[model samples]
Target chain A: MMRRFPQIAPPLIALAILLVAWELGVRYGFLKPYQFPPVSRIASGFVELSTIGFPTGVSIWSHTLTTLVRVLLGYVGALALAIPLGVVIGSFQVLDKLTAPLVVFCRSVATLSLLPLVIVWFGAGELTKVFLIGYGCFWVMLSNVIAGVRYVDPVLVRAARTFGLHGGELFRRVVLPAALPRIFAGARMALGVGFMVIVGAEMIGTIEGLGALIMEARTFYRSEITIIGMLIIGVIGFAISAGLTALERLLLPWAGNLDAVRR
Target chain B: MLDHDNLARCALRRSEAPVAKRTTSPFLQFIAINSVGKTFAARTGSSISVLDCVDLTIAENEFVSFVGRSGCGKTTLLNIIAGLEDATQGQITIAGRPVTGPGQGQGVVFQQHALFPWLTAVDNVAFGFRKSGLNKTDRRQKAMDLLTLVGLEAAASKYPREMSGGMQQRVSIARALALDPQILLMDEPFGALDELTRIELQHELLRIWEAQRKTVVFVTHSINEALMLSDRIVLLAPNPGRIKRVFDVDLPRPRSRTEPRFNALYEEIWDELST
Candidate 1:
């Protein structure tokens, strides 16, 4: 099994070699340090910021933690609201048709486009950023969930009926479990939307997020800090996505391939 | 030939076997449709009668097959018996009571495998017990038992997608059995499989049926299949479908298609079917 699995090599070694070449290019002045900072410069920038802070006293951990908390709050709230509503809307063709145009229009109205309106309503505080992330995540999650329910194979429903399952029992036992793979896919997509929205939302009114940190570094000509913030954002995105994937595998162990379910 | 009065008496005595009690109730074990007919509205708003005044009685623990070509309303009749659709006229009864809606004694296996892809083989089998007053563990246990009955204990944890086509049909059969209805209704359950798999499943089905001894109403298009599996084969003709003839298959268990008697029955049914 170990031989078949290609157990000797990891992708990290190749990535390290590339990073070294990039750092050398910057050091030899083949590439400008400011436009494209090296790994050493980014690492030093991370250490300096974490110790002395990106702003005056707020550390790098504080910024990342703040962003994580806001996104979590909004994403969880959206899921709690969307799933039931999506099930109801998805199960009924009439309800889906009636809400189709409304859902489309709302999805098209970009979350950032509502930032000005949100500020007027909730002020330029934390509420505005959370609301923006919530707004973005909700529709993407809801649409995918509704589609998941609506598109379930009718053969499964017929099979369930033959078993004497109907009404709520039918929905919970058959419909919901059958729709789970797609719903999990929707959740993964929703998390992505929330992440993107939070970054954009935090760039303006707060210095306590990766987005704010990067923008602040650009203004102070600490380009190295900007690079570190981008890398941190990338790492966070990768980790969150992988976490959701593992969770999906755990919950729906019977799911096959998962190409359609994993966005 | 069986007399009408004798058939009626038989049906009336065993109509409630699967519905009222789990015990070996002699009162309700058969499926009887008395002068039942189905008519559906066409796209042009004209009504098309699918079945007309169809009357049949399948005895307790009998394997009855209904055979006809496509558009012959065989599947429609099975649906009516299953209570999936209401007959436009006449009465259809299972276990003595008129079928108004689904979920009584009718455990139906479709032409398609129809195993739930999301559930493992055992889980799909036991899904019928969802409303059967069984707890989670008990239902799963029953499901496992049914899968074993269908010779699928090894693949109990495998999903529908993971199993072969014949294996999927086996799971579907096991799933229908989980309902534990007095009557098992199959609408061309092996019609979708290849020649080899289909023949293998037919034998597997006979074995399972012999062990379970549930009254069965099977629909198929093939004359050989009907002659091979059924105790009585009901031949129906299209264009306002009605039963043309009912032949009692006297072949013993595991009857071969190459045997003289089997070939004679096949030719007999084929002639009746084609004409």
Candidate 2:
């Protein structure tokens, strides 16, 4: 803990200085109050968001929970579909080749660009937002899962073979475990994609998420609330990724330094 | 002291003699490499011959070494023997049964330690017992025994990346030995290690070989290493790799490098290799 003090102190100090400077700039009229809300206003915005609530009975906690639920649903749905499909596709050369162009085309189509089409299909509801998040997360997760399974080191496979491992036994014992680090990386990346897509999806229709809160705040000219919503999103993202990293460490104790495995 | 020149001449004469005439007992001919040749098709549509009509016989428990420079197809020959690769023109048989594919009682230790990165050292070793029908606890105990043999019992739970290069190779050796194979085929197993580690592994390997009494076919670029460990050294020359000469090392075990006979044999093999 003592050794980490020097490393941890600088970042905390930098953030404090920036916040103080921003507050002073707003108070001194150096920065426009409407454009950049002072530190005090943002702090009050936080308190008001939690206590008195935004718009009516919907508090910041509810908004955060709503966003979390949406992201998790979409992320989980994407993983459920992608993982088995990816493993099967990656195992066979012909399947991988056949789907390559289609996968690439779908990934390149842009998740938000399909917002109008999705809204037209499903209407401006929770399902529309969830579908958009799933679509965005699916492609990223699928590609990563496929690459993970496909590029398992040939040396490892040959080593397994010398012990009489072949076909499904090889796939289960060697290939699956070897592909895990990459698969976990895909999950983390897919979650990030889901998070990004949800914000945009929420902005179009719904006033119960951080994305909707910020968008509504902009229309009401409450820039402080908008800034608070943005900060909450950042905090949520950081917490989620950190949680995932911890989960990965817990599950894959043998996988040292996951970054090294990521292509 | 024996005359070095005379000894060299005698060795050359012995090598020149026909393979069938060299051995007296048919029972000792455990492995037969009958005119084994390998040809790989190049990307440009031409086939490149790697091994050309190579024939050698290994006894049941002989410690033989194939010493040659790079591109000499030493590793290729080892792979062929292991049944990891096929010889386009000929066949290799162990105990009179033809080698069709991998897992034919051949335990191979590669140049690079190929331990599964995700598995612990003990788990990696236990991977060899997949077909043994041993219970998990029994398999683990057996794996621990192999790890102990390789002097890596303390590192049983450690992952491959957690250990040093030498330690990883030790685990790899343990894993290969776990297969309980009839023959041990090593392709420059210690080639990646530092000099000290390499020497240490050489002694360890010798000790293991003495204990296990398994036939070993070791490939290396180092003549001194071959002199230290091998019962006989087979020299292979590059283009369409074929045996150039063979030397019988009759020196005593725990052989000293400074000894006159060891130096003489090293010099003789070095001379043959460079030419």
Best by lDDT: 2
**DockQ (Cα-based) per candidate?**
0.43, 0.65
- Would you list the clashing residue pairs of candidate 2? none
Positional deviation of residue A33's Cα in model 1 after best superposition, in angstroms: 2.9
Please compute and give the TM-score of the first chain of candidate 1 against the native first chain: 0.92
lDDT of 1 by residue, A226-261 (tens): 888777778888899999899888888778678665
What DockQ results for candidate 2? 0.65
Model 2 Cα lDDT, one tens digit per residue, A97-162: 999899989988889999999999999999999999999999988998898899999989889989
Q: How good is the docking of model 2, by CAPRI class?
A: medium
lDDT assessment of candidate 1 = 0.83
Q: Where does candidate 1 stray beyond 4 Å? A: A1-21, A27-30, A257-259, B1-30, B34-36, B47-55, B116-123, B130-145, B154-162, B236-248, B268-275
* TM-score of structure candidate 1: 0.84
Assess candidate 2 and give its lDDT: 0.88
Error of 1 at A130 (Å): 0.4
**lDDT scores for all predictions?**
0.83, 0.88
